[model samples]
Target: MNSASDAVKEIVIEIVNSTPFWTAFSACFIAYLNRNKGKKLTAEKDGVKFSLENMNHHEMTEALEDAKKIMVSDNGKKPT
Candidate 1:
């Protein structure tokens, strides 16, 4: 019984230590992360969608400027 259990344990450890298993696991994990990292719109108006992940530097700066303008116009009042 002890020998059989040891054999099973070794087999499980071998499978876990194999390169193919690690490679497959890494590929799946990367795919999962990439899938989740995709562009997600935070706001939309007049058919224009805003997504930080998809924006280039210029677009981000423009959005930041627009937000600053809105904030300034609001003068500490939260929009309802």
Candidate 2:
């Protein structure tokens, strides 16, 4: 019983000491999973939402042009 309790205490101590490393590893793994290159983007306005992932070539080009026009017209200020 005494040796068994000592082994459990050692295991607990090891886990506590390794917490920070495991936490960092988990964070890096999650960040790698969420890396944004080539990720789908969604736009929302007036409660309407659409995903660019579903758009094809023509639609995507048109959306890009519309976005450019809006930016130019707004002079780059946030719209209220």
Candidate 3:
């Protein structure tokens, strides 16, 4: 590669690898990717299903209970 391109590549690698000043680009990039996922809550039964990305306390509780019931009924058997 050309010197200029090689220098740019080296700088990017250093930015991603350095952590002393918490200036690592990779750290921020990973955090940004995780931040986009948010929280996911889901419940499914036979042919029915429910999902929540953002939910209230009441909804969270209800969804969790539904999930528990479905899990209990599975009785150690795994889905195909």
Candidate 4:
């Protein structure tokens, strides 16, 4: 019984240490972490909430330009 248990333990350890298992596990873990890292920026104005990530490139550029104009109009205060 002792020898049988030891063999089983070794087999389990070997399986856990295998390259394929590690590769699959790493891929899944990285995907999970990236999924959570992709949280969109949110803003609330006039009691309306919206996500910045939903904007297209043109819209993003326009918004950034508007922000720069605002900053420039505020006595040439450079953004930190």
Candidate 5:
């Protein structure tokens, strides 16, 4: 069990070591988006619920940038 744990750790180490920053970032972002789905920016405004699907492409892109900015600022760390 200890050796298995060590092996797993080694594999993780290799993966993290070999992965480029952008690739890791993209993977994490995709996973986050997948997990979030309908939860992303869903809000009740007035009597209407707003979501990313309601936004235009430019607005959606800006919203994503805003979300990334908030995340990085709050955590003091870049995604992935």
Candidate 6:
């Protein structure tokens, strides 16, 4: 048998654990959406500008892994 305090403590712990899940999800969702918004805003405010298309394969892979680390770091997770 647990006291009322114990139940409340469990609920609080659960909420705390769940918070980062929601926060990371929302952050990722918002970041994805912002990319589209950024493109649109850039096109509207700035005229067509040339962008690089080609990237070194090795460098590109490294850059991607770096980005993954940043995105996953907040969740206390690491990239494989």
Candidate 4, 5-51: lDDT as tens digits: 89999998786656555455445434443454544344343444445
Residue 18 of model 6 has an lDDT of: 63
Q: List where candidate 3 sits over 4 angstroms from the true fold.
A: 1-41, 45-47, 66-68, 71-80
RMSD of 4: 20.2
Report model 1's TM-score to 2 decimal places. 0.39
* Model 3 lDDT tens row, 14-60: 65344432233224333433465643334464445655445444444
Q: What would the per-residue lDDT of candidate 5 be over residues 1-80, giving only the tens digit for each residue? A: 57988999998766644435335444554455456554343433344444543455444443443222222212233433
Off by over 4 Å in 2: 1-39, 44-49, 68-80
- The 10 consecutive residues of candidate 4 with the worst lDDT sum are 66-75
Clash pairs, model 1 backbone: none
lDDT of 5 at 8: 95
CA shift at 20, candidate 5, in angstroms?
4.8
Cα TM-score of candidate 6: 0.26
Best candidate per TM-score, number?
Answer: 1
**Runs of candidate 1 exceeding 4 Å displacement:** 1-3, 38-80
Clashes of 3: 0
Question: Candidate 3: worst 10 consecutive residues by lDDT?
Answer: 71-80
Clashes of 5: 0
Pick by TM-score: 4 or 6, better one: 4
The TM-score values for the models, in the order shown, are 0.39, 0.26, 0.28, 0.37, 0.30, 0.26
Tens-digit lDDT track of model 6 for 1-80: 99999999998767645645445544444454344333211111122232212323343233333121222212222322
Clashing residue pair totals per candidate (backbone < 3 A): 0, 0, 0, 0, 0, 0
RMSD values for the candidates in order, in angstroms, are: 18.3, 19.3, 16.6, 20.2, 13.0, 15.2
Q: Candidates ranked by lDDT, best first?
A: 1, 4, 5, 2, 3, 6
